[model samples]
Target chain A: MSEKRIEISQLGEFGLIDRINRQFTLKNESSLKGIGDDAAVIQASGDECMLVSTDMLVEGIHFDLSYVPIQHLGYKAVAVNVSDIAAMNGKAEQITVSIALSNRFSVEAVDALYQGIKTACENYNVDLVGGDTTSSAAGLVISITVLGRAPKSKIVYRKGAQVNDIICVTGDLGAAFMGLQVLEREKQVFMADPGMQPSLEKYEYMVGRQLKPEARTDIVFDLEEAGVKPTSMIDVSDGLVSELFHLSRHSEVGIRIYEDKVPIDHMTFETAVEFKLDPITCALNGGEDYELLFTIRQEDQEKIKKHPDIHMIGYVHDRKNERVMITKQGNTVPLRAQGWDHFTE
Target chain B: MSEKRIEISQLGEFGLIDRINRQFTLKNESSLKGIGDDAAVIQASGDECMLVSTDMLVEGIHFDLSYVPIQHLGYKAVAVNVSDIAAMNGKAEQITVSIALSNRFSVEAVDALYQGIKTACENYNVDLVGGDTTSSAAGLVISITVLGRAPKSKIVYRKGAQVNDIICVTGDLGAAFMGLQVLEREKQVFMADPGMQPSLEKYEYMVGRQLKPEARTDIVFDLEEAGVKPTSMIDVSDGLVSELFHLSRHSEVGIRIYEDKVPIDHMTFETAVEFKLDPITCALNGGEDYELLFTIRQEDQEKIKKHPDIHMIGYVHDRKNERVMITKQGNTVPLRAQGWDHFTE
Candidate 1:
């Protein structure tokens, strides 16, 4: 109530997280890892540990209901949380979804949302265990918490990447961002002329990437089947270079990558150019891709080298503060983390 | 998108919850129970099992900032979720707190909110594990998921109550509802006259109950010390009568109670009288008390009869579909569930 005000934008999202993380220390021994990881690790029993992660998606900030179907929003909410567990090299077993909505949403609309949630639960093989549903004063808000499990020995953290570890990523990047761009354009066109049917047939793949991104739980099992374990892992929710910064900070190492090695789908590239955006820049800075960005020891590289989806994009090095990218034209330049920051935006 | 519309208010809160619950069946062996109790039960390991519960609080729907301090809001949010774990006869070990706030909240306000969360964590000995922070388009929203553990042998469920079991409630009821009346009255007074100072000295206890209700976790410890395992239990969050209906429906039994035996604080009774409200009706339907309501076998009555805070008010019977209360005037009346339904409101 005082006149003194400090805007949250000044701290940004990461700065605000740091401010909170500094205040609480883990007191329980069951809490193996606390705030700094992709998910908190709790000792379940003996050599097994539980992974817990949560995500909150607000209506206007996280999604535009005009273009996003209610069902896809529900599915995406669960997938994003499951993706967090996968980032820790664990399989999500259960999820609790809490939703708040205004009366503007109908009962049939609620049914469609749950239909999508049920589909995601079946797809991920995760139980829809519990949740709280309450009415909101405004738009819809969905918050999901996922529970996962992994053997303590196999659980990977973002801080374990050693120097010379081969950096790997699952699937291509920047497609979801491009998909959002296409949706926004279509939404604008439709808004300007209500009778106009925005043709999205050409951009269906990119639109699907934006509307219903899938969690790469398959990649976790594939890595295990290939007899390889990532030294460090994180999901690419906040663009490629931004997540690389997270791994570099946690592992206390430097990153060196090649622009040409970074995988981008031809469709995504063509769409980015059509929108007057740089494809590689979009890959580096666009958010919500939900792919796995991880590092494996150099010795383990041969194990997954033949895998089609896994791309060796970069390597870790001893220089702790240096993160550079070798361009397609053989120019070495510093990589900027233009990841999504909702608070500042 | 359809011309045929079904309003959510038509189904109400419980009705909507039932619609969603009917869609998903628990598929995992680790998931012991889902969507029908205070917390979901999951198989942890060996004799231990885990309890998971979540609650989402919206700004205008759950609290009004003009009267409720940000710190108390934070504390109450955690306490309510912790109470759910207690309702399952388990001790909460870790919690994930997700918050979404608009730019209307300052950095200092966020700091205050976390401070309250930190205090609750220390008081309850719960570890702050993992959470998500995002921007909201409107007011602040907090969603918390609490994780707890208990021996499988000791875990309690709502369906475990038996005929002739003594029903018990902890602390007093209706005080929180009285507190809200006082706050709302004072707000109206202040709105009519800006220079008028709200007089709250006499209603401090009730007001505190509304703003910062504490979970009856100590009662769980006391029951363990007394060696009395409740046959069934639930937190008194939706008033005494509504929660009793829950126990009746889950256990398929009848409930009989004495109006004179239901615990009501002197201050709460006096305040309700001053406001021209029936003290007994307020006690039966007033919510947010955060007290424990459970049923115990007749043989265990001797174990906790002398405990000052634990009140024996009723008994369960085999006559299903009959839930009644005996009045002080010697009249038999069926109890009605006027529990708070945010959707209908």
Candidate 2:
């Protein structure tokens, strides 16, 4: 009830998180890991831990209904939460999805949304557990919490990376960002002329990447199969550069990446070129790829080196304050994280 | 893309949940329980199990900011999620809280909200582990997920009631509902004349019940201490009749309650009469009590009969389709559930 009001925009998302988290202290011995990790880890029993993560997606801030299908929205919601668990190298066992919608939606629409949720659950071998269904005053909001399990020794955290470890990434990036651009363009065109058809067939892959991105549970399985455990892991929901910064800050290590080694899909590269955006920049800064980013021990490099989808993009180094990217043109530039800044334009 | 738009209001809240859940099937061996229970139970190691539950509260739909303080809202959000775990006879270990707010809110407001969340966490002996913070276009939204632990043999479910079990509820009912009425009336008076000072000292207890209700975790402890485990259990977020119906339907048993056994505080009863509302109806249909409702075996009844707060309200019977309330005058009437139907007026 103080008369002084300080706007949220003055402090960005990370600043706000730091401010809020500073006030809380963990009280339970079962809480092995708290606010700073991709998912919270709790000790369930001997050598076994349970991981929990929650995410909330608001309508205009997270998605546009005109471009994103309701079913895909549901799928993406569950997938994102699952991705948090996968980042910890755990197998997701269950998920609870809570959604609030306005009267504008229909029963059929809700069914379609749950259909996408069910599909993700089936694909990830997770059970849809309990949830809250309620009405919202405005647009739709979806919140999902995923529960996962892993051996205590196998669980990875953002602060575990050591100097000289090889940094790796899963799948190609920038596609989801390019897909979002295509969807936005189509939406504008449709708004201008309702009769005109959207020319989106050529951008189908990018569009799908934006609409229904999958979590990298497969990568977690592959890593375990190869007998490789990541020293540190994080999911790339906020651009690669942003997540890299997080790993660097949390692990207290420097990160150096070769720009050419960063994987970008051919369609995404072409679309970025057509849109006059730097493909490498798009690859570094495009958010919502739902890909896994991790650092592995120098000794474990050979085990996962030949994996098809696994890309060795960089290495962790001893220089604590420096994070740089070496361009294909032989220029080294300090990497800047332009991740999703919800407060600013 | 279908032209037919069936509004969500036409089906009601429970109808929407039923429609959505019908399509999902559990595929994991670790998933011992799913959508219908208070918390989903996941098989962990030998004897331990993990319980997960989620709840979402939207701005105008669930609370009014004009009368309800943000701190109380934050506390209530955590309390409700913890109540779900208590319903499963489990101890909550950790929680993840996700929030979405518009720019209109200040850093101070966010702090106040988290202060309440931290208070609840400290009081409940749970860890505030992880959460996501984001911006929303409309009003504020809060979604919380709680993780709890219990022995596999001690976990309670909603479908385990026997034919002759005694129905029990903890604490009093209808106070939160009447408390809400008091706040609404005060809000109206204040709106009519801004300079008017509202007099609310006499209704402090009722007001607290509405603003900051506690989950009956103590009852779970007491029951365990008395060597009694509920055959079936559910938290009374929705009214007594609505929760009774849930227990009956899930357990495939009938329920009969006596009017004289229903617990109502004197202030709440008087307030209901003042508003020209039926006291029995308010006790039966009023929501947000956050009390424990469970069924106990007849043999164990003697153990809890002297507990002051535990009310022996009803009994389960063999008739599957019958749910009735016996009046003090000895007339039996069918019980109807009208518990906070969000979709319907």
Candidate 3:
């Protein structure tokens, strides 16, 4: 009872992970790489490597069942875990999804959830290998572990980025953030007036981004086909600036991205304006857009220079801790990341 | 909403798994086997194969924080997952433990939980490769996925037990169930009078078994050393009779286990009597023992006959649907499995 008490918020989520992960070292030889990557890398047979990643989504903290459909929840859960494997430039082959839910969820509800999971498996060409379902004392919890593989030569790590490498991102950023905003606004309106019906037709694009995000596995295949392997890669689940910080720290290089070059969907920008928020800030700091961010060597830039889905945003610098963004009016600003800190009150 | 109100309890856990797993087929060549086992089998190179399994433990549903220490909960969680690998006759190499917890847990509490996880990792020689830690809106949720490997020749499944195979079990049975009964009794007493000190001196063994159940990985090593391969193997988590039912159903063989041969610690028997419960019934149907149950070919039984820990219980029979138990009094009774159905109110 007299033991010391420390608030988890004092050491945020990242700090907490660092503290815990520091105590353990990779002991198994097959464990090629452990904590601190999008996915752990393992030595597989045939001189290939495997990628393993797991994510747990809690109902109330991660999603509100009242607004988010169970089907989309199931799909998003699979997509985010697959995004981790894709971040390692690997194709996810199998996934195990375990869920814990209370009796409030019916058999039909579970069917709807699995239908979406099956849909994702078909979409990504992944197989559902195994999972456990147990009763929860409270709200629903879904945890998915994905196993993937790539040839040893094709595998990439966050520490592979180098000076002058092009920093590229797949798909537009901030749309999913804007989508969440619209969903929240609509939920409030509906809550305030119970008899009023919600109209989501106009905001479907943005809402869908938040409800059903997809992993950019196709881009991994495209890069392999084009014979351009990214030097370093990470999934953009924690906002552009936050993931950039990860790549910079691990690769020990600085980065400079132009704000004007940051990709933003038309609807995202429009919604940002309507919400009286800055589109650029949302693109830089809003999370949950499961896009791939990676750096490519200068010589490989011509391989996919005209690829419409890929956007070249910046270049890596030589010095670490010197990340910046050039504004449209020739002003350079230090990029700030207000990433999610769930532990913080 | 009118589609279906079928209760999950109607199908039961195994039936629900059957209903769900029947819809999906393994599409990837690397997926050697999917579902219907303690772990999933995946094709690995070098004449070996890999095993993967997952288990999710919800806080209130799986453990009562008031009586269960967080550290032991963490240790037991990892141990149970490792037991799944051992059930497949494989060595667990890596595990990803993802947890979602609310702010009620402090930094010190999280540290205590990780201390147990780290201890288990060191004890089992399994690497903690990767995991996701997120905030839960309510109670704590821990989901662990383990990856293991074994030579193809050594791998064992539940379907391989043949008629006349000698059934074996590792370690004593039903102590953990007795342990839970002891703990729950002490908890009720303490709750009735908070000032009363819990007299757990005499119940240390049972209490330990309940709080810290160790996986029988040693039996796997012993079997290998003895050059004996179990025709089929499974971990006895949900009571001995339930596991026997699984082995019987999967192997398409009936089972005849002698009640006199079911190993029960003397303390467990006496404690069951103290709790006004039948000792044999407790050994047969009480869950969470985490023992290894298997069937060895009659010729291979001699190799492990003298193994100090392994107990030869009975034999597999030819009649697929006829399972029975021979009591010490020389009477026979049909074996029944009142398995753990968490969905039941």
Ranking the candidates on TM-score from highest down gives: 1, 3, 2
DockQ of each: 0.88, 0.82, 0.82
Q: What does the lDDT read for residue B212 in candidate 3?
A: 95
Question: lDDT for model 2, on a 0 to 1 scale?
Answer: 0.92
Question: Over the stretch B198-244, how does candidate 3's per-residue lDDT look in tens digits?
Answer: 88878788788889999888989989999888999999999999999
Model 2 Cα lDDT, one tens digit per residue, B129-191: 999999999789999999999999999999989999999999999989989999999999999
**Model 3 TM-score on chain A:** 0.98
Best candidate, lDDT-wise?
1
Identify the leading candidate in terms of TM-score: 1
Tens digits of per-residue lDDT, candidate 3, A178-292, equal 9999889988998999898888887898899899999999999899899999999999998999999999999999999998889999989988999999999999988999999
Give the distance in Å from residue A116's predicted Cα in candidate 3 to where it truly belongs.
0.5
* Pick by lDDT: 1 or 3, better one: 1
Docking quality band of candidate 2, CAPRI definitions = high
- The fnat score for candidate 2 comes to 0.94
Order of all candidates by lDDT, from best down to worst?
1, 2, 3
List where candidate 3 sits over 4 angstroms from the true fold.
A1-3
